[model samples]
Target chain A: MISVLNAGNWAEQYSTIGERAFLSITMTVVGIVIVVFVLTLLTVVVSLMSRLINGKPGGKETTAPKRQPEAAAEKAAVEPAGSSAEPGASASERASETDGALIAVITAAVSLALSDSSQPSAGFKIRRIRRV
Target chain B: MNSIVDFFNAFSETINRLWQGSGFTNIQLSQIGMILIAFVLLYLAIVKKFEPLLLLPIAFGMILTNMPMAGIINMNFYDPDFITSLGYPENTIFAYREVLNEGGLLDYIYLGIKLGIYPPLIFLGIGALTDFGPLLANPRSLLLGAAAQIGIFVAFIGALLLGFTPWEAASIGIIGGADGPTAIFVTKTLAPHLLGAVAVAAYAYMALVPVIQPPIMRALTTKKERGVVMEQLRPVSSTEKIIFPIAVTILVALIIPDALTLVGMLMLGNLLRESKVCERLVKTAGNELLNIVTIFLGVSVGATATASSFLTSRTLLIIGLGVIAFGFGTAAGVLLGKLMYRLSGGKVNPLIGSAGVSAVPMAARVSQKVGSDENPSNFLLMHAMGPNVAGVIGSAVAAGILLALLR
Candidate 1:
C-alpha cells in the first residue's frame, strides 16, 4: 500500500459499472499474476540461498556438530561416579570425553565469575590445554 | 430604568454568543453518533480485548475528532475543495507555511499516513520481529502465501460490482490480505477518505482471526486432512538466515518497484535482526520506534473517520466487503492447502495453508489449535509459520500490484 506517487490522473477511472467491473477483473488478474510471480520468484531465491548456505538441506553441520557435544556431555555425566560402561572403549577415548567435560566446567566457572559483565567471556582466558 | 434595561439586553446578547460557541450547542446528531460508535469500539478493545494496542488510541482519536467544533481534526485541509479555498492550486507544492499556519494538529500528523511513512515503519518492526527460518525451511509454503492473495482480487471484484471506483475498490480489497499496515498503506494513498472504515474493518477482522478462520478452515478440510501432522522443518543455518532478507529485498524490489518501500524497510529490519550485529538499532526499531509510530498512526487514522466521510453507505459497504475479503482469503488458502495435501500424497496438512493470509501468529495459532483438536499429537505451528510469514510478503506484493495497476 505504499503508493509510490500522488494520486494525480489515476483517480476516478471507469464511471460505468460495466467498465469498472471489467477494469476490476483486469486489475484482479494483474494483481494475482504479479503477486504470485514475485513471491514464487522469492521462494526460488530463498531455496537457492538455503542450498548455498547449508550445502544441502540437512548436511554436515546438521549431522556433525550437534551430536558431538551431547555425546561428550552424556559420557562425562555418566562415567564419573561409576565404572565405565564400555569395556572395549580405549582409555584415550575416555580422556578425550573428560577433556570436553573439563572445558565445560572451567568455562562455566569463568562465566559465573564474570556474570556482571554484559559479555561474560570477555575478560577471562583459557590460555592453553593439553593432555597430561 | 432605561440604563437597567440596556444592561440586561447586553447580558442576554453575551449569553447568546456563549451558547452558540460552546460544544454543547454545536454538537450535531452525526457527531454524537460517531462518538457512540467510538465508545462501542472502546468497549470492544477494553472488554473484548480486541487489538487494544492500536484500537485504544484510534477510538480516543475518534472521540477527540468528533467533538463538536473542537477543530482538533480539520480533515477539510486534505480535501481538494479546502485546498482550493486556501488560494492555491489544488495540487500545488510548497504550501508548507500556509498549511502549518492553517492546519490542525491531526492534519499535520496525518501527513505521515498521507505520504506513506508509518505503515512501512511498522513493517520495519514486523520484519525485525519475524523469523523467516520456518519459511526458508519449506520454500513451497510461498505458494500458499501467493494463493491466499486470491481473496484480495475477489474482494476487488466485489467492490467494483457494488459501484466503487477501481482505486477505492483496490483499497478495500487489501483487507483480504489480513495485514493491517498494508491495508492502511493502500487506503491512505488511493482512497484516503475510506481510511477509517478500512482500518477499523481490517483490525477488527484481524483480532477475530481465531473466530472467523476456524469455521472456514473446518468447513473446507476433512477430519483426516486436519489431523495430518507436518514434518519438522530443517535446521536453518545462520548464514541462510542472514542472506534471506537481502535476497528477498532484491528480488521483490526488482520485480515490483512499487513494493520497494514497504518490502525494503521490512527486509532491512529483518536483515538488522538476523545480522546480529545491530542489536541496539533493532531494539529501537522493533520496540520504541514502533510503539511511537503506532500511537501516531492509530490516532491520526482514527481522526479521518469524520462524520461526513464515515457515516456513509459506502463505508458500510466497505465493512461488509472486508469480512468477505477475509473469508475468501482464508478459504482460498485452505482450498490450496487441500490441493497440496492431494499433491503431496497427504504428507501436508491443509490446516497450515490458512495461515497464508498473514494474520501472523494468530492465523498460525488457529491452524495449530484446529489441528490439535483433530488430533492431539499434531503440531502445525512451525509449519503454519512458514506460510504465515510468507503471507506478509505476499500481501505486500499484492498491495504493490494493486497500486501499480490502479494508482
Candidate 2:
C-alpha cells in the first residue's frame, strides 16, 4: 500500500538518526579539544623547565655603546706586554669602566620585568655585548 | 462538428483551472510585505557593506520564498489524491478537511538553519587565521576574555524572564556575544523557530561593532585612562606559541564538556596553523573551505525566513534584546580592562579589554584605534589580539554553558 511506503510515518527512525548525528558531532569536538589541550600544556611546562635550567642570563639590553668597555677589557687581556704600553690613565679609565659596565648589566636585567615581550626591541642579546 | 466543439470546451476548462492556481491571491499581502522587507535588507547589506556576502543571499532567499505560487521549496511531495486531499491534517469537526501544508521556498532554508552546521565551520576558518602569539606573550589576557562572556549569561537570564522557554532564552542570549556562528549553533539546537531573527541580529551587530562600542567606551573611562600606553610585549618563543592553543583546548574542555565541538574545531584549526606542519590544510580551511561553506550557509539560512513564520512579534523582541546583549558584553570587557589597568599599575591599556567581545579583528582594531587616539604613538593591536582571541573562546564556552543549562 502507498501508506506503507510513507516516510513521514517513520518519525521514530528519523528522530534516532538525528540524535546519532548530534552525538557524533559532539564527541568528535570534545575529543579534539582534550587532545590539543594536553599537548599544549606539556609543551609549555617542558619549555619553561628547560629554559630555567639551561638558559643564559641577561639575554637582553646589550647596546653597541655599552659594550665598548667589555671589548676594551678583552683587548687589554689579550695584548702583549712589550707592545708600547701607553697604559697610563687608560688603566684607571678601564678600572672605572669595568665598574660602570657591571652596573649597566645589572640595571638592564632588572628592567626586563617592566618591558613588554610583545616588542622585539625589549630584549637584548649577550652575544652583541661580548662582541663589542 | 459536435466532437470538435467538445474538444475545444475541454481545452477552455483546463485553461481556466490553470489560471485559477497560477497568479497572485488576496491572501498573499504578507508575502509581498516580506519580499519588500527583504529588499531593504539586501540594500543595507550591499550598499552599506554590512556583511554583504551573507545578507545578499539570505535576502534573495527571502524574496524567492515570498513569490506567489512558486514551488521552489515545496515541502510536500507524496500527498495522494492531489486535487482533494490536503497535504497536512487539519483539526476541525465541521470541515473535517485536510489543511494545505503550503509548501514554500522557505522550507529548504529551514533545513540548513535548523541543523546547526554552518556557523561552527566558520569558526574553523577563524581559528586557522588566528595567531596565538599575543595571547601567549600575555597569558593573563585570557582572564579578560573570560570576563567578556558575562554578556551571554546575563542575556540568558534576561531572555528567560521575558517568557521564552529555557532553550529559546539560551539561543537568544548568544546574540550578545556578537558571534554569528555561536548564535547559529545555539539557535539551531534551542529555538529553531527564532534562528533567522537571531542570526540577523548577531551578524548585524558584528558589522556595527565600531559604531556601538565607541560611546560606551568613552562613557566608561576617563581621558587619562584612555591615554595610558601599554609597554611593548616580549617575543613569544615558537615553542610557547605552539603550546598555547593546545593548552586552551584542554582547559576549556575540562571546564565545560559541551563547548568542545565549537571550541575544538576552532583550536584544531589553530593547532594546524601553529604547528607549521599542515600549511596546505590551514590555507584551504581558512580560505577555500570557509568561503564555500559561507555561501551554502547563507543561502540555506535565508530560506528559513518564510513570511508567515518570520513576521511575528517574537522576532522583533529578539532583535531588540540582541542590541542590549551586545552593549552589555562590550561594557563587561571594558570594565575588566579597567580592572587589569589598575592591577598592572596603568601598564595595561583597558582599551584592549573591549576586544573581548568575540567580534575578532574588528573589536581588536577598535581597541587599537582608541589607544592611538589617546596616545598617537601607543600601538595596542598585538595586545588587543590576546583578549580578542580569548573572547572567541569565551563566547564558545558561554554557549556551551547555555546548551547544558537550557537544553
Candidate 3:
C-alpha cells in the first residue's frame, strides 16, 4: 500500500492500480462534497438576501402581493362610470364596457383632429392603439 | 562556357533547397491527418456555425502550425540538448526564450494564453454580456449551478484512474464545468501539455450542449416536472445589481484568493455593466476587447495541437472523460432539481436544474425547449437563466478550489 502521507512524486507514488483507483475515488468524493457544500452555502446566502429585499421566500406569487394594489386601481379605473350592476360583475363584461368607452373617446378625438387638418376623416377608424 | 556551367550548378542547388523547404516533402501522415482535422473544424465553424468566433481562428491556427518549417510553435522545449544549450535548468516551468528565438507569430501570440492573460479578459466580456438579474431574483438556483460541478470531480477521478497525473486529471476534470475560459485557464496553469486536447474538448462539448443535455434532462425529469411553471421573478433594485459584483468579489477574494484572477475579472466586468456609468468600458470589454482576445486565445491554443501532442491515448481518454463529466453534471443538476421540486411542493421545474452546467444561454435554452415541449405556456427561460449564470460563478469557484488544493 502506498503511504497517503508521502509527498513524493505523485506519478510514482500512485503508480499501482490499487493506489490510483483508491486515490481517484477518494478525490472525486471529496471534490464533489466540497463543491456541493460551498454551493449550498451560497444558496442560503442568496435565498436570505432575496427574502430580505423582496420580503418573500420564493416563486411568482411573491410579486402578486406587491402588484395587487396597482391592479385594483386599474380595475377601478376600467369600471363603468355609473353602472347599476353588482360589485362582482363578470370581468369580461367590465373589460368590454371599458374598451367601448375608450374607443369612442379615441375616435372622437381623432375625427376632430383630422377635421381641423381637412384630410379625409370619412374613411378613418382606429382599429388598434398599440403601445409601441 | 565555364561561367555558364557555374551558374547552372548554382541554379540547380538553389532549386533543390527550395524543393526541400516546400511543405509537401516534409509533410508526414500524422501532420496530414492534423491538417484534415483542421479542415473539419473549419467546416464545423463556418457551415455548422458551431461557436464560429473561436473555432474559426482555432482551425486557421492549426493549419498554420502544421505547415512545414513555419516554426509557428516550438514543441521541442523538452529536448535536453535544446534546454542545455539555452543555459536553462532542465524542465523549467516554460521555455519562453526558446519560443521567442525559434518560434513564429503564433508562438508570440501564444504567450497570452501561457502567461494567463486572455481567459480573464474573455471572462470580463462574458460578465459584461451576462445579466445576473435572473440569478439575483432566484438565488436558490446557485445550488443547481453547484450541483453541476459534480461533473468536474467525476472527470478528475476518471482521468486519474486512466493513468493521468494529478495535475493532468484536475485540468481534465475542469472541462466538466462547461465553461471554456475557465477550462482553458485551469488547463494552462495546471497542465500546459494537455492544453490543446482539453481546450478542444471543452469548446466542442460546450457547442454540443444542445445535443448532449436534453436526453439527460428528460431521463432524469418527468413530464409533469418539466411542465412546472415557475413564478415570475421579483424585480431587483438597481442598487442590488451594483452591489452583487462587489460583494461577490470581496467574498471570493477572502475565501479563495487563488480564484481572484478569474472571479475578480468576471466581477469587475459585471460591476462595469451594472454600474451603468462605465458604459464605454463595458462596450469595449464586451465587444472589441473580447473579440481581440478570443482571436488570439483560439488561434494560439489551436497552434499547440501538433500531431505528436494531440494524437495520444491520453487525449482520447480526456475526450471520453469530458463527455462523462458533462453527462454526470447534467444528471446531478437535474437530480438536485428533483429534490427542490419535491421540497417546493412541485413549484420548481426540474428542467431548470440542467442549466446548472454553466454553458450559459445554451443550457438555459435547453431547459426552455424541454419545458415548452411538456407545456407550451411553461416559460423556464428566465428561471433557467438564474441557474445558468450561477453555474459560471460556481465553476470559477470550483476552479479556484482545485488550484488551491492541486497546484
Candidate topping DockQ: 3
Q: What does candidate 2 score on TM?
A: 0.70
What TM-score would every model get versus the actual structure?
A: 0.83, 0.70, 0.87
Better candidate number, 1 or 3, judged by TM-score: 3
Candidate lDDT scores, in order, read 0.86, 0.70, 0.85
User: In model 3, what lDDT does residue B19 have?
Assistant: 94
> How close to the true structure is residue B326 of candidate 3, measured as C-alpha lDDT?
96
DockQ result, candidate 2: 0.03
Candidate 1 lDDT over B164-257, as tens digits, reads 7777888999999999999999998788889999999999899999999999999999999999977667778788888888888888888888
User: What is candidate 3's lDDT per residue for B1-407, written digit by digit as tens?
Assistant: 99999999999999999999988799989988889999999999999998888888888888888888777777565334666777888656557677767767876888898789999999999999999988887878889999999999989888888777888988999999999999999998888878889988898999999999999999988888888988777777777788778878887788778888998999999999999999999999999999999999999889888888898888889999999989999999999999999999998999998899998899999999999999998888998999999999989988988887777
TM-score of chain A of each: 0.36, 0.32, 0.45
Score residue B283 of candidate 2 by CA lDDT.
97
Query: Clashing residue pairs, candidate 1?
Result: none
Q: Deviation in angstroms for B340 in model 3?
A: 0.6
Report per-candidate DockQ.
Answer: 0.27, 0.03, 0.31
DockQ of 1: 0.27
Top-down TM-score ranking: 3, 1, 2
Which candidate would rank higher by TM-score, 2 or 3? Answer: 3
